[model samples]
Target: MPCYLGIDVGTSAVKALLVDEEQRTMADATIPLETSRPQDLWSEQDPETWWAAVQTAVERLCIRAPAAFSGIEGIGLSGQMHGAVLLDERGQPLRPAILWNDGRSFQEAEELRRFHPELSRTMGVIPMPGFTAPKLLWLARHEPETFRAMRMVLSPKDFIRLKLTGVCITEMSDAAGTWWLDEAARDWSDEALAATGLDRLRMPELIEGSAPSGMVRPEIARAWGLRGDVTVSGGAGDAAAGAVGLGAIDDGSAFISLGTSGQLFVTTHRFSPAPETLVHSFCHALPGRWFQMAAMLNGASCLAWAAGLLKSEVPGLLRQTEAAYRGPSPLIFLPYLAGERTPHNNPYARGVFFGLSPETQPVDMIQAVLEGVAFSFADAKACLVQAGTQLSYAGLIGGGSRSAFWAQIFANVLNIPLSRYEGSETGPAFGAARLARLAATGEAPETVCSAPAVIETIEPQPRLVDRYGPRVDAFRRLYRALEPEFRNAPTGW
Candidate 1:
């Protein structure tokens, strides 16, 4: 039986998945990765760690399913988007890979927004510190030596592709996040690159997400004990890859991705730029498709942090919160642990717990955190609507999809049905495998990208929806009231 491999270089972990021609997953392995924070608002990871983790994950999957692994014919790459990996002359990393969540480039992003205001529509969205271009600007100013020595720039997964294929190439979806890609044209913009003192030469070649970039190196194939020349497909950024995995390819197909960070992704048949709303409009993994997304820096990770602070496990806290659930928590939380995106593009925004009282219990705080995340999704839904895409329903995927309680909360908060599919949590990697199949077999994506079976659908409870109306309004008011303070506050505060 022929098999395909999908490897996702995610922030918290690298996941490797192997699937047979029948589309059944045979083996999966996840290897944890570490991020470094030498200073506040900075997140970096060693590119070498990603390479090592990929090897380990693939080795583990091979060991788990030797027969299936040996039949691997194609490989797909997927990972976190907007990470800036600077390479030196010998393709050596000049510095740690600055991640998507890093906020050190806020001022640079602001400068770009002011000077290149016209570029927003072409680039998909207003420049943010989290985007790759602003990171380059920040480096050019503070670490000019490193910037001058830079030979190339690659996103997180493409960096892994460099090791696998001995070629530096990226797909449209990932490239769209770089603040360099012309979204409507689905190609890199020379003018945009020049904004950061870069040219096309320093950038990777572009391809459609399912197109083959190059064959895996012979040494890499032999070391992994593969059967033939493994073709590596240009997969996608994690968000688009997740959309592919969920089979959300048609116009207006939408989903909610609640991982370490969250995104409200709506597929479009054409490039629909919504720069004013701060919603990302970019090319989809499949050809002739695009998507509008509202990205939030905080997601399920906020729950994990709350759990740690409350000295409990996530499962335990969720269970307690669910059991003690009432109409709504009086308290409200701003899930801005790493600042925010979408509706509010404030990187300086900090997390705040309001309405805290001596009468508040741990369960109330837990419920508030969950509701805060739910409210954040509400903002996402509103922004997508403002961008002219009304969502009828949304598929739920990523680590947070495991919680039925949270799914119901999102449903009530958004007042729309939330659908959860079988194996939704395996989103990016599974989607990558599908892209691999497309690359290797030259198969049509419609047959190959069929939506998975829906396991459950949570409908909005009318009473709960009505109750959340006031709370959501209050959430918006609090953010608007606090916006000026956040902008004026000192960074370290």
Candidate 2:
């Protein structure tokens, strides 16, 4: 049977997935990666490491399942969005890629907001420190020589795609996060690029996620033990592709992702900019579909940190908190480990635990952490609703969604029905594989991107509703009360 391969160049690792026409996983492999933080609030990674990880992942996948890897007909690329990978004319990176989590551009982001007062309105996103535009401005100011040497800029996955096909191209979904795209028009905005000292020539050619962007080079194909004619789809940003994996294409369809960074994503058919609230409005992986998203910079990573702190595994921690979830704990956690994105674009915001007392136990803290994340997603839902996007239900995906305890809290806190689909746990890699199928077969996306079988539906429980309702108010108020202090907090606190 013919198969498709989807590779996601994520922040912490590169994931390679192989799937057949019916969306059955044939083989999957992941290669670990690391980020360099030479300075405070700055994140960088070598683009060469990303390409090397991709190669290692693909090689392992082929070794694991040679039959499926040999039958692969098309390739799709997905990755962490908003990363700035500057390259020279020779197609070599001039400097380490500035990552999405990097905060060295916070001042530049504020400067852009002032210089281009209408930027949020035009770009449908507030220029946050995590965006690509401000990162470029930072480079131009701090590393002028390297900046002048930059002949092209690409997102993380596009850098890998270029290595594979010798083509530099990006899709609407990823481009939308770059602070350059005119999301409503589904193309790069001249004004936005000019503000960042970039022009159209430095930007990658735009394409829809499902469209054929290029083909694998002969050498890459031969080295990877694949066909030379493998088609390449213009894959999506990780969130958009995750939405596609959940089949959240129809208007008002939403999904709550609990990956390294959490996001509450709602699909929209029309352009709806909520920049005032720092909500992300971007193009969908599928053409003609747009989405409004509220992102939380901290997600499952928080739990991982907590697990490490408590000297226990995540599963054991959840089990220990079972009793604590029977009622709401007075302790409230702010899940802003990496600062925040939605509703507040405060990069300086630090994680805090409010209402902590002498009686608080580890179990209580764990429960509070889970509830805090749920409340954060609830805030995103409120922002979407306030912006006039009505959500009836949302699909739940990502690593943390594997925990029944957390999934239950998300459904009750958001007060919406949550559906868990089969195979969605694979997230963006699965979606990219489907996009690969679309590129290779020329099939309608509706036919190829069908939602997987729904295995369970979680509705809000009255007890959970009553318990978390008032706590949600406290969660919001605490952030507001502390916002000023957060702004005034000393550096490196």
Candidate 3:
């Protein structure tokens, strides 16, 4: 009867899920979150808003299933990766947390890479504007006073853990993306800290994803109508957590996450560093596990953008695009609305609707947008394959996975089977819940982390694959041709 609560502190929302020992969902709740962009290339959110959102989300869950909430025995945390939440001595946030998509730290990233030439090898990634270390470096350079006052730095989810358990702790998977953790050693690297002008003193306690970090505060337990013995598990980064949710933890196990940002996540047994190719190699939520991820800053968000531009609901857009799903559309969308991460790593990149003509219809535009996102994932898959990560099939999870058309397109573009599992739509929150079940029952992850029953398997249609092959090629060439223009263009452009 014991249930677990998994909370995912996402970029645009806070999601809470309750699952029993058998991994069956008992209840779930979500609270929408808003990010602030005070300047170009900047994305931030008040850490306190995350705290409040968690409380509100949990309160709603309790209302839906009071008995299940009362039986909650453990908590797991998953969140947007690489976010920088600076806390003072009293554990209060010094400023708004910089998100994973924030690009203001590009200069700092370059400077850090220059100072630590071996950084890519050490962190298993090319230092980009979004990672946590660069954000810290940016703070040191531009906000020295605040940086000096910083007592701790935590990711978005760990910030919530601080509020829940009155402890400051982070796990390996999330830490791996910080560009400070040694992925091979599964610990914070002193050399990385030195390069960023940060010391181990400011870092939180490091634990593995499955390890118990702390116990819930008595007050929080009572307020949320939960048992006093609820333990907290070291959750994971959003992608790793989503992989965990899908039970994609073994070698060769991979998944495509189409959330606010997209990631082609492939699990690896060894510490695989693909820095030269811009592939992200990092630890998985579980111990002795590693994953390589190629992230795209824009994912399902592109569909949202299109919806806003066309003044249509997402469901309606999907409905309209059904007829154009496999049809030819001369238009191609770049899906660089928030810039790009994988392959290009160009923060200045802008979205483009190339090949548009007077005959183009709204449905053609929608089809192009979806195809563009799919092509971007195809690019990430190519990098992973080049890095020697062999993947025959992958699970699909996230808000975009609800679209069968999108799933089919991904399968065709990637030329592999894409499985959609029952309850996979919950994504990271459910993965966190599974981790919570592990912590609560001391169950072997193999027993508890198994993939849920697949509801459908999207196999690549040969004709569609052939159709997309040339278009995917064109997608790559288009980006290469536009790179120089993006670099030279003014900020206003």
Candidate 4:
């Protein structure tokens, strides 16, 4: 039986999974990654570290299931989107890759939007600081030397692909987030590229997520003990991969992703642009499909930060908070630890606890953090609705989806049923494996990309929804009140 390997170069870690033809995950491994914040509102990482982590992850998986690993016939790649990986003529990184959560390019993004307001409808998103084009523009101004030396730009996963196959390519889902892809055309937009001082030559070849981009280099194949050069599929960005994993390919199929960053994504059959509401209209991993997404800058990262500050493990802290939960916590947290996206699009906004007092307990803090993240999703839902996308129900995927308590809070906060599936935390990796299968066997996507077995459908309890209703109002009011403050924040922060 043939096996396929899927790797996700995530913001927090590199995860690899080996799956057989029967859709059984044979082995899995993960290697943690770190981000460097050299200055305020900036997040970056050395592109080489991603490639190193990928190698280690695959090595661990190979050790765990050598039989299955040796039978691997295809490889797929997925990763966080909107990262700017500038490369020299030798395909060497010029500077640290600016991440999706980084906000140092806010001015550049604003400038781009100001000059080319009309492009948003075709580009599918208002050029935000988090997008790649703005980051490149920032570099061109602040680090002109590095920008001049840059010969190519690749997304994070495609950087790893460069190492794997000595080839450069990116799929539509990931490219769509770059603010340079023409979503309606499903191709590069020269007009948009010109705004960033780039052209088609700087971009990698664009392909659909399930299409074959290249083969694993023979040296890599030999090291991995593969039978031959494995076919490498052009996998998706994390969001689209998660959607594919959940089989959210049809019109109006919706899901929420709670990874390092968060997203409320809805699949659509047509390319419907909705930039007025700050909702992202981007291409889906599959061809001839698009999605509207409200992307949040912070998500499970808030929980991680809280856990670290409290010097506690996440699981234990969550258990404590759930046990102590009655209604809402005594505090309302703004989950803008790394600023916010979606409805606000405010990069200067920082985390705040509005109701902390002498009576505040540790568990109360944790609960507030969880509630704050849920409330942020509520903001995302509101944006999607404003963009004319309705969410009667949605699937939940990513590292945060493993928390039953968190999922329940989301269900109540959003007032919609959420489907949870087994191994949902690795949805992108599994989805990549599905794409690998399609590439290796020439299988029809519909047959290979079926939804996995769902463990439960979390429904909104009326009592909980009613309890959260007033608090949601307060949350919105708090953000509105603080918007001016965030804008005028002291220079140090």
Quote model 2's TM-score.
0.97
Q: Tens-digit lDDT track for model 1 on 300-397?
A: 99998899998899998889899999778999999998889878887888899999989999999988998999999999988888988898899999
* lDDT, model 3: 0.90
Clashing residue pairs in candidate 4 are none
Once model 1 is optimally superposed onto the true structure by TM-score, how far is the C-alpha of residue 281 displaced, in angstroms?
A: 0.6
Q: Write the per-residue lDDT of candidate 4 for residues 1-493, one digit (tens) a residue.
A: 7999999999999999999989899999999999999898999999999989998998899899999998999999999999999999999999899999999999999999999999999999799999999999999899999999998999999998899899999999999999999999999999999999999998999999999999988898888788766999999999999888888888998989999999999999999898989999999998889999999999999999999999999999999999888987769999998988788888899999898788888899999899999999998898888888888999999999999999999999999999998889998999888888887888877898888789899999999999998998999899999989987887556
| Global lDDT of model 4 | 0.92
Where does candidate 3 clash, by residue pair?
none
The C-alpha lDDT values of all candidates are 0.93, 0.88, 0.90, 0.92
Name every residue pair that clashes in candidate 2: none
Q: Name the lDDT value of residue 447 in candidate 2.
A: 88
Model 3 is weakest, by summed lDDT over 10 consecutive residues, at 323-332
**What is candidate 1's TM-score against the reference?**
0.98
lDDT per residue, candidate 3, 98-181, as tens digits? 999999999888887787878788799989999999999899989999999999999999999999999999999999989999
Q: Mind giving the per-residue lDDT tens digits that candidate 2 earns over 187-299?
A: 89999999999899999999999999999999999999888799999999999999888888888888988988888899889999978777898899888899999888888
